[model samples]
Every structure is written in C-alpha cells, then in structure tokens.
Target: MKVLLGISSSIAVFKSIDILRGLLKEGVEVQCVMTKNSAHLISPLTLEIISGKRVIIDLFEKRERSDILHIEITKDADLLLVAPATANIIAKFANGIADDALSTIFLASRSPVLIAPAMHTQMYLHPVTQKNIEKLKSIGVEFIGPYEGELASGERGIGRMAEPEEIVEKAVRMIMKKTLKGKKFLVTAGPTYERIDPVRIITNPSSGKMGYALAEEILRRGGDVILISGPTHLQPPIGADIIMVESTEEMKNEVIKNLEKVDAVIMASAPADFKPKISLSQKAKKESIQYLELERTPDILEEIKERKGKKLVVGFSAETSDVVENAKKKMISKGMDVVVANDVSKKGIGFGSDLNEVIIIDREERILSTGIKRKKEIAKIILDFIEKKLSN
Candidate 1:
C-alpha cells in the first residue's frame, strides 16, 4: 500500500522518520511531505534517504509526475498519516483553509487521513484546538494519541505523539477495516427524560459529551452511525443517523427495534431509571400539595445485550459514590461486555463538561484504565480497546 507520510510543524516531527522506516520495512511504499517549519526540526534529506523518495515541500515543486496523480495522494494511496500534526494545521484542515503545501494536499486528498497532534498541554486543551479536533473527526479524520508523557515544554501532560509502533499498528488496522466497507452502526446517546409536565421533566444533565464523541469516532473509524439521541440542547453529532426522542419509553422502544442489525450497539445514553407515572401535556401549576407516582423504564441496554448474538454491547455507568462498586453492579446487571465508570462529582470534569475521568470495568470486574482526559481522547481509548477485543 502507498502511504503519504505528512509531517506538521512540531518538535515531535523527528518521530515521523521511525514511522516511515517501519512502514517501509513492511514493504509499503512511502512518500514524505513536510510542512515548512517541520523541515527545520527534521531535515528533508533524512526523510528522502529513509523513504527512498524525494521529499515534497512545495506543492508545485518541479518533480516529475507519473500517470498516478501524485497531487491527489489521498486518491492514490491506501492511507495518509500525519504525525506531529500541530494545532494550526488541524484548524486549517477543519475549516477547509488551505494556506500551505501540506494543507493543500490534505484538501485535495480523498484517502483516509490520520492525525497525531503534538503540542503543549495548554495548547492541546485549549477550546479552539479542542473544537478543531472535534470538527476534523466529524469529517472522518482519524487520530492517534497525544499520550500522557513528557513534552517539549519541560512538563508532563497529554500532548505527546503516539509511539511510532502504535501509530503504525492503528493505521494498518484502520485501513484494513475498510473491508467492512458499507457496514453501519446503530448507536444511542445522551440522557433521556420522563416528562411530568411540559415545563418540568425528569432527566439527567448528562451532557451527552461522551456518546457524541463515540458517534464521531465511529464515523472516523469508517462505520455508518445511526445515533438515536434524547432531548438535549446539544447539537446532534454530524455524520450520524440522528433520531431524536424525548422520553425514556421512546428511547427504549427504538433500541429494541434497531437491535437485530448493525455492527455494534454503544448504549451510552443515561435513560432515566424511573419515569413519571403520568406525562402531562400542559405545564403543571405551582401548588402546595406535591406528590407523583413513578415507574421503572424499560432496560434497553440489558435487553439488547441479551438478544445480541454476535454484536458488541458497550454500556456506561456514572456514579457519584463507590464508583467501582456501582460500576461493577451495572456491568453485571446490564450484561455489558464493556462498562465505562466515572465519578461525576469533580468540578470541570465529567457530566455537562468537556472533560471526563473514567475507568473501564470489564465484565470480569477488571479495571481497564483510570484518569482524567478529554471525552474525545477517552472515546478513542474505549473504541480502540473494543476493536482489539473484537479482533481477538
């Protein structure tokens, strides 16, 4: 397979050479492309010698073109991997602003684009950078880790590029999964409501950040997404099959109906445990007397898990106390192969916020991971873990 090894302006650009060497060792052809600043950190001569191809810096460089349109490497190659992708480049690609040679090729390419962003923790966590990363994934851009480790800023945080070996492995797996081409996924997201009146409803302010991130990741990993969402002010994740519902009962029935199909069911929605006995059409008037009946909602996640013959079932449990204990209970009760548990009491993290701290308690009650990170990054970890499990 032909690969476009694009390098962005980051100190970590030096790592791309190892990635190129590994790919070439696998007998894959590689053409190196570096941003103007990247060339200063890592010499173009080193890449040319390593890949056995002249590095392309200027888009219109006087290089001979074969019948293969080298300009549209995205169209000709099996994959395009951009290591040490910087925030500037990520934003340029997100808004379709192509101001440089690297950006131009990205715009012209139709091949799968994989980006590994590297920068300071502050820059990586900045709202603008976060939004750009979100937008890129919305358009089918894959990501490897900006892992938690040392950084050029003389501090340790989450802005390190993924190890070269891991990046290559993920790239290969992603390219191979295109064989499941045209395969689609049916995913549910957000917290559901059980209305008591037009104005007042029983719903969790779950934020729906994680589920939305998962839906976006599904699109990036090359699967069609049918996202059944509950009523939330949050915008529906783009590149998904959006079906909006207002009540737990509505979400429950939808899950049962869509269960027979799809490659996987990521039951990330926090459907209300008990809904109001009566759903009033009009807003309720304030009164001194207040009493209402409640009833259990359908167990959508468990029902689907039981009925799922060969499909994947993933569930989420957000606990305020006894995080591990409650998560384990839910994993068994819900019959979920994988359960994501997190404490939502911490400020600036989990529920209604952009970040989350989570632990993956498998069916065996084994803790998979625990830490605070952006929901998008966490979603990638969970999705990659599940993909590995499915492969085994």
Candidate 2:
C-alpha cells in the first residue's frame, strides 16, 4: 500500500510523526507533504528521516528527478491522508485553493482522501469551518476526529487530534474498497460475567479483541455495525454503535432486541455456560460457603437460530477438544451459516491473547483454516467469507 501523508500547521502536527511510523509498520510506502507553516512547528527533516522520502515543502522546490512534485507524489498512491489538518488547510481544500504543496496534492490526487482535523475548539466549532467541513463531505472527502481532550492551550474541548493509531486505522479503511455497504451487522464480544455472589462472578478469558476486530473490519467495509459487548477495558471502535452488557442474560436480551434490524450476526462473545442456581444476596461468609448449585445459562445462539428468519448467523466455538468436529456439529445443530472454531488450549493464541487460529466450517461442509495470525488479520478473512455468503 502507498499513502500520501499531508501535514498542515497545527500544534498537533507533531503527532503526524507517529502516523508516519505506523504506516511504515503496516508496510505502507509513505510519501509526506508538508505545508510551509508546519515546518515552523516541526522540522521537515524529521519527517523525511521517518518516512525515508523527501518531505515536499515547496510547490516548486528543485527536485533532482521530478518537476511537478505535487502531481508526481500522488502517482500510484492508494490513499491521501491529512493528519492534524488545520483550519487553514481544510478551508483551502474546501474552496479549491492550492497555494502550497499539501493543498496542490489535494487538488491533483485521484486517491481517496481522509482528513483528521485539529484546531482550537472555537475554530473547529465556528460556522465557517463547519460549512467547509460539510462542503468537503459532500464531495466524498472523509474525516476522523478532533477528539475531546486536553489541548496545547491547557483548555479542554473538542479539538484535539485523534491518536495516531486511530488515524492510521481510519486511513487504512479509507484506502480499501467497501464491500459491506448498505449491510447492517450485529457482533457479540468479550466474556459475559455471571454473578455468583454480591462480588464474585464466573467468566472466561475473552479479551473482546476478536469481536472488536470484526466490528472495526465491518466499519472499514462500510457496513453499519452494532457491537454488543461484555465488560472490557478496550475502547469501542469509533464507528460502531456499542451496547455494553454484563451477563449472558443481558447480552442475549440485547441481541434478541436488535436481531431483526441486521442482515448478519457474528456471535463471538463467550457467555458463561452455567451459573450458580441462586446468586447470594450478600458476600458469602467463609463458614457459610459450601457446594454451590449450578444451572445452565440460556443458549443465546440456539435461541437466535430458533427465531431466525433469513438473517445469516455466524458462531464461534472456543474448545479444548474435538475442535473442528464440535464446531461443525454446533453449526449444524444451531442452524448457523458458519462456525469459527479455535483451540483455546493452544499456547500463545486464543483466550486473552492477541492472536488466534481457527477453522471456519459451514453447514455445506466447506471448511477453511486460517493458521495462527493476529486477530485483526483474522477478522478480514472472516469478513471476506461473510461477504461472499451475504452476496449469494
């Protein structure tokens, strides 16, 4: 992947260095373009060293190999990203004013564009800037955040630049072709907690990473996503509609409530299979504690399948034994279109880990094994399968 990264004059421009590094880590060839004013805040040589490409600063700067630098930089580029996009740059792009290297590239590029706006709270909220933003949006230009947080001015409002990681994710998504547009999806993630007492609970080691990755991939594909998740410390993907649930019952309720609105459902949450027959009202006293009776929690996937009417259902089975066989049986029994099975017992993968290896089996006996890989990569593979299923 090749990205044309543009930087403008915002104090937040410093964050673009991280953005450049992140793109490089993703194996993207990055060419950086900086407005003249941005050089005053951060040296262009700094970005040049990080990107390993000459940072374009002047529209007519002498180039040993090229004359039209603005036009040349965007050739074969997959995406054009403006990080720490200041009000000046946004206005210039909106009004078709190409006075500098960055704005000139904006006018000349054919690639999809993403802008991460950063400015004073008042400047961002000003009617003029808002109009410019709307105009840009109308023309197919996408934007991420000027998220709320502490600013250089020591005043907190909604104009701080989004984190570099987020910017890079958005940039990657922007460069991809949307396959799930007009489709709505529901994803259940994390480990549901079943309270055993006032303070104690039963849960699994699910980190919610797989499910959240699914949501992010869905959003990247331009799908509408509802993420119903159990308690986890991870930040919810920005474009997803999040529903937080604590127990299996709550998760089931939310899923059942919104099931009809979505075209497909990805059930990645690990709901407790059993719970204490009777939850203690108060903390269990050491002397009073004895054998606790257990009862099976309601099977959410089974229930959804029972009531399913044309909607595609995708399930996950994290098993220590019978991996593929059990997953196939579950897929058949539960009427799932596909079941992703993983061995949670494996070292370095599954459970609370960042990586997973799974076999995807459908009722048709079609199976595909994705060897151990990062959850994010696994998500794209899953989506690729789901997209084919939905298309048919």
Candidate 3:
C-alpha cells in the first residue's frame, strides 16, 4: 500500500516519525510531505532517511520529472493522511487554499483522507476550527482523534494527537481490501454464567480476547458485526452492534434471535455446560450446601443446526486431549463448516491469555494449525480463510 504522509506545524509533529515507521513496518510505502512551518519543528532529512523517500517541502522545488509534483504524488496513493494537523492546515484544506505542497496535495488527491488534529484545546474547540473540520468532513474526509489528554502547553484538554499505534491501525483499516463489504457476521465472545443462586454462578476463565479480536478483524475487513458477548472486562470493538448477556440461556436466545440477520455465525463464546437443577431464590447457606444437583444447559449449536441452512457456522472447542480429532468430530456433529480447537491444558496460552495455538478443521476434514501466536494474528488467519470460502 502507498500513503501520502502530510505533516503540519504542531508540537505533536514529533509523533509523525513513529507514524511513518509504523506504516513502514506494515509494508506500506510512504511519501512524506511537510508544510514549511513544520520543518522548523522537525528536520525533513530525518523523515527522508527513515522513509527512504526525499521529503517534499516547497511546491516550486525542482524535481527531475517534469510532471506536476503535487498532482503526480497523489495520483497513485491509496490514502492521504495528515497527522498533527494544525489549525492553519485544517483551515487551508477546508477552504481549498493550496499555498503549500501538502495543502496542494490535499486539494488534488482523490483517495481517502484521514486527518489527526493537534492544537491548543481552545483553538480546537473554537467555532472557526470546528467549522473547518465539519466542512472537510462533509466532503468525505475522516478524522481520527485530538483525544483528551495533556497538551503541549502542559494544560490538559481534548487536543492531544492520538498515539502512533492507533493512527497506524486506522490507516491500515482504511487501505485494506474491503472483501467482506456488504456482509454481516454474528460473533459471540466471553464466558456465559449458569446461575447457582442470585449471588453465585458457574463460569469459565475466558477473557474474550479471541472473540473480540475476531470482531475487530471482521470490522476492519468491512463486515458489519453483531457481537453477542458474555460478561468480560474488555472493551467492545468500535462499530460493532453489541448485545450483553449473562446466562447460557440468554446468550442462546440472543444468538437465535439475530441468527437470520447475519451471513455467518462464529460461536466463540464458552457458555456453561451445566446449571444447578434448582436455583435458589436466595443465596444458599454454605453450611446447608451439600451434593448440589446439576442439569445440562441448552446446546446452542444443536438448536441452531437446522436453522443455519446455507449460512456458514464456525465453532470453537477447548480440549485437553485429542484436540484435532475432537474438533473434527464436533464439526461433523454440529453441522459446523469450520471448527477451531485448542489445548487449554498448556501454560501461557488460551483462557485468559492473549495468545493461542489452535488446529483449524473444516467439514471436509482438512486441517490447519496456527502455532502459538497473538489472538489478533489468529483472528486475521481465520478471517482470511473465511474470506476465501466466501469468495469461492
């Protein structure tokens, strides 16, 4: 992917270096464009060395090619990003003033534009700046953040530039192939509780990292997500339609209710397998509790089997032994198109851990293994497989 990195004058200008590096780490080709005033804050040569492309400063600077520099630079760019966008640049962009190379590129570029603004809190909140921002947005420009935090002035407010990692993540999402566009997915995450009493319940160690990762990946690929999640301390991915449920029965009901609305169902949640035969209305006395009876919880996969029809169904199995074999069997029995099985018996992976190693089995008995890796990486691989299946 190719990106036009536009930098304007601001104390947050230092962050542009990290942003450029992050994009390069993602295998993105970056061409840096700097406003003249920005050069006073950070040297253009510094960016040039890191990006390996000569920085563009003056619009009238001599170039080996005779082509219009501003227009030519933007023609092949997949995206145009302005980080540490100062009030001057923002106003110039909104009013179509192209006195400098960066503003000129903004006026000439047809690609998706993302701006991260940085300025004094009062300057950002000022009606004039806000009007300019809105004007840009009305014409299809997108903004990341001027998040609330300590500003360059040491006064805390809402004009701090978003962190480098966040800016890069948003840029990647904007440039990635929208293969899942117009598609919707239903993803369940976390662990469901089975009531033992109003004060007690049975649950698992699931942190919902895997499920949340999958939801984010789906969203990044342009798929609409209905995230049915059990109790977890994790934040929901942005842009997901979230439904919070507590018990296995509630999770099952929500899944079934939203089933028909999605093209695929990913059963990533670990719902309780059993529940108390008779849940007490009040908290059970510790002394009186002895040999409590249990009953099987509703089998969500089984209940949805016949209703799934042509929609793709994916299930997860957490096993201690015969992981692949058990997953294959479960895939067949539950009418699932794919099954992801992992061994939770090992240390430092699965459950509450951010990492996982899994064997992916298909209904056809084909198997693929992902050696222990971050849940986010695994999420991408799963979605890549799903995208391939969808395309075929």
Cα RMSDs of all predictions?
Answer: 13.3, 2.5, 3.2
TM-score sort, best first: 2, 3, 1
**Of 1 and 3, the candidate ranking higher by lDDT:** 3
lDDT of each: 0.81, 0.91, 0.93
Candidate 2 clash total?
Answer: 0
Q: Candidate 1 residues 39-102, lDDT tens each?
A: 8898899999988888888866665665333465667687888997999899899988877777
* Shift of residue 360 alpha carbon in model 2, Å: 1.3
Off by over 4 Å in 1: 1-183, 364-366
TM-score, one value per model: 0.58, 0.90, 0.86
Model 3: CA > 4 A from native: 14-27, 39-72, 125-127, 145-166, 197-200, 278-291
Tens digit per residue, CA lDDT, model 2, 1-392: 89999999999988999999998987789999889999999999999888888888887766687557777778899999999899999999999998888888999999899999999999999999999999999999999998899988999999999999999988877776788999999999999998888899998888999999999999988999999999998999988999999999999999999998999999999998889989888898877867879899889998898888999999998889989988888888988999999998899998889999999988778889999999988999999998999999
Q: Rank by lDDT, descending? A: 3, 2, 1
lDDT of 1 at 27: 64
> Which one is best on lDDT?
3
